[model samples]
Target: MFKLTTAAAEQVMRAAKEGGTEGMSLRLAATQKEDGAIDYRMGFDAATEEDIRFQSEGVDIVMSPEDVPLLDETVMDFVEIEPGKPHFIFLNPKDPTYQPPADA
Candidate 1:
């Protein structure tokens, strides 16, 4: 299953409220690039019958069946990579360039 960090969930919830997408599930999509990198896209959306639905950190999430394998066991996080910019990032072991976070 996929995981969503608390920070990520907070950001998503905030965005949904601000964007008027409340009550909708967050849709996540993953595609493998030719070079073996995994690309991720996400937004608030209405889940279809065939979509895989789950909840993490009180956030409703949806993903297509075909995207499950690539996203399985992935952890999504929102962090400050630079001084003032924080954004979402996917920690997917299936991605070739992915590196596990070191123990704190």
Candidate 2:
């Protein structure tokens, strides 16, 4: 239960268009680093055993269920911090009406 921002959606759509894929999705998943730190990633594909794809407007983002709890009400934002080094920000828990998944 999530929505994409105009900018984020546009960026994703552009990427999908470039790739020329018939379908696209964005998946959000979590993983543990070698140091036991938890991290997340966004991928493009359909939902699978370890990947969940968020597809909309020709954009595809693949992720894992392990990160669903952290992605609730998350908003993707882009920032031009420096010259060409743009950064994407994850604004989590942004919606008061949003609910997070129970498990990680």
Question: Which one is best on TM-score?
Answer: 1
Give each model's clash number. Answer: 0, 14
Which runs in model 2 stand beyond 4 Å of their true positions? 32-38, 49-64, 93-104
Tens digit of per-residue lDDT, candidate 2, span 4-100: 6677777776666787754656666555456644455665566676665565444566666667665655667655659998765555564343345
Local error of candidate 1 at residue 28 (angstroms): 0.2
lDDT of 1 at 81: 88
- Which residue pairs come into collision in candidate 1? none
Q: All candidates' TM-scores? A: 0.97, 0.60
Q: In candidate 1, how many clashes are counted?
A: 0
RMSD of each: 0.6, 7.7
- Tens digit of lDDT per residue, candidate 1, span 30-60? 9999999999999889999999999999999
